[model samples]
Target: LDIAFIVEGSDNVGEENFNIVKKFLERVITGMNVGQEDIHVTVMQYSETVTLEYSFREIQSKESIIEKVRSIPYQGGKATNTGNALNYISKHTFTLVNGGRQDVPHLVYMVSSSPSTDVITRPPRSINVIPIGITPNANIQELRRISQPNNPIILHSYSTLIEEAPELVLQSCCSRKLWTEIPELCNKPMDVMFLLDGSSNIGASEFEEMKNFVRAFIESAEISNTSIHVSVLQYARENNLEISWNVPQETEKLVEMVHSIQQREQGPTRLGRAIDFVVQNAMSESHGGRPSASKVAIVIVSGRSEDTVEAAALSARMNRVSLFPIGVGNRYDEEQLRTLTGPSAANRIMKLQNFEDLSTMITLNSEFIKKVCMDPVRECIDEDGNKKKPGDKWTLPDQCHTVTCFPGDYTVLESHQINCERMPKPVCHSNLPAVKIEETCGCRWMCPC
Candidate 1:
């Protein structure tokens, strides 16, 4: 569970009003049952609204989190432009939010004392935006701007300030043993770099497969709905740019663009070359604003390659972007295949194990892409702002609730990310000391494990 908070530190408000805002935030934090270890706190104070405070990661102790929340100094000036604060928090802070991949919930809490006169042109990226208006005159437009009236995006008002703090915790970290498994993808923008194999060794069918996988991801999760922007080209016989940086939200165009891929070109499967392409590109785009989610992922697929993928895989791993390599067949390098999984067994690069069924393979790949895009796709966007792209969507599991970094059901978590393809399997971590659910998985017929 990852939690990010924003409180009005607008300069125009009075000291008394400032204190009320701080206390209101503190009470809510205390009541959320947010423990020290369960959350990473970021304080954005708005006077002229520069991110007055940055994030303090993983404070498990509620007192520690509260003290940090209280540490926000009061500043008052003119009208409360909550939109600026929201813009700052949306752009400047939040990349470290852990539960981004649509598997773990990410929660953004906004407590404001005034209104925002500006119209947000940038889109909002996080999954759930919870806006609580502390003042009677608090900007309802800003509140509605941050939230959706229906579903997870909530905009509820109180008659007065939160006079009393709830004595009990909203939810406990340890008690919610299932936290990691729950499908809670945040609406924070994510930084994703995809590395594709362009070598001639990758076949026509495989090329089409790769292209569609990218297309589905671009259409279903990218564009206006997500923060994921895919780059690079097919590395086969010729190297060409299919998508530079922009990702299409609507599937029709992306699908058309990909299906129309008449050229399958690039050099020898330079897997390392592709990974390096992303690393170099990503470093330059590092905007100062704290993104809604932390880290990025490098995805690679190849059938054959002369150079080793170890160095590239390790480099991406160090950058906090995991290297996911898909091996096309027995001829593909298993060592490199395994290497992409990284240092921990949990990070082991998983193979399709069977490729006889293209539909299953494509479905599995699509599911993985959906899970991966959920967070950064959420992060890279500004909810109240203009839609970057439109006609894309990724729905969360029912067990999931509005993002709060809250713990989720135990069985649904596998790698702390959800893969919808394996429905009813009670996805779980195999490396863990124990296994809980006994129910069989939906793909049991195909399982030879």
Candidate 2:
């Protein structure tokens, strides 16, 4: 990776604070691998003018780089021209002559205490803004505009810079993919159990579809002993453990096992018994349940349970086991599913028209399920600064965009575009005119005769 630090050297950040900034850079650089073949770093100080302290080609070893940063004198000026600094680095710093490679990823860190006096434009490379000491005067919106999306680091005072150096180093070492992708996509340990309904009410074909749904979910997840440990159980009159979490299996092998699972279409659906069995036998330490891992159960139901489920569901929740119940067909009682999910039924339960709909529903809602498994706390802060739970949907004001908060660290924003060409033209009488009215979905024509 190639990194550039654009330090603010204006009068606002006095000589004492400037020394602290240098210390911050030294600590961050020390944490990273600094060699000719590895990370290359460039340092520039900007006030009314931008001055290159060093380029990537000037320093190679970690010790030499630390010494150079310590020896460099502060360039103090009256005005903070951040735009000039960004433009200078984009033109001169990241070039072949300066030891910048085409294959290496480029990152720019802008440390500033005052807003730019000139117009700030987005640079070609990825930029992260670090605003320190002057939060009230810092142009947060403009800083965000110039930096990468959601990539601004704010510090109340320069004294806090040393404390945050470790996290800054960690962020610097991350690959470009990790920075661009959703934060929750980062792996977390989870123990997931698929509790299948294999009663007589569901046909053999429907049971196969259920298996396919489970297989699809497993295929998409990062399955390993340290990541997501999966187990499957088929329940009817009796419970059959198809796959045990205790047995360590690769993802491909697990998928094959799920494919070979035959339907146990025996007596009536006794889902309550299955729930109780999982809580007692499946989620125990002896059964391969990790104490640190989040426990999740995806229960697929075909019809109403022959036994009561409310008490069993309550027990599961009390043990910190999250239950997501997918109700298939109209035969199952909606109220029972709601009771099974307890207070958060609206978000936890999914009702499908038939077994065939499972594929489509899984494709669309897989992220939602993954979020549930990864984020045990089950809350996210949206762009509007509003607290939202998983499955909550809201429309953006004055725009045709809808935002949904999934369980993880990200929120999905969907645009509802109007297909004006598909709509037929409205007819108007000779004496009256037609008026166009704007609606959330599209435009509508109103005529008065």
Number of clashes recorded per candidate: 66, 0
Regions more than 4 Å wrong, model 1? 1-186, 222-227, 236-240, 247-250, 282-300, 345-348, 353-449
- lDDT by residue for model 2 (206-239), tens: 8877886776566556677667888999999999
Q: List the residue pairs that clash in candidate 2.
A: none
TM-score of 1: 0.37
For 1-449, candidate 1 gives per-residue lDDT tens digits of 55556666665456776777677667766665454444545556654555545454444566776776677667665656665666765654545453222344555556665666555533254434555555445654355445531111112233234553222112222234212232324255554444556566666655655554555344334443344444435554434555544454344555566667654555566666666555555433442112443445445454656666665654554444545565555667776666665434324354654222222232222345444643222211111222222322222232221112112211111222343355553433453332333322222212222
Question: For candidate 2, what is the total of clashing residue pairs?
Answer: 0
What TM-score, computed on C-alpha atoms, does each candidate reach? 0.37, 0.44
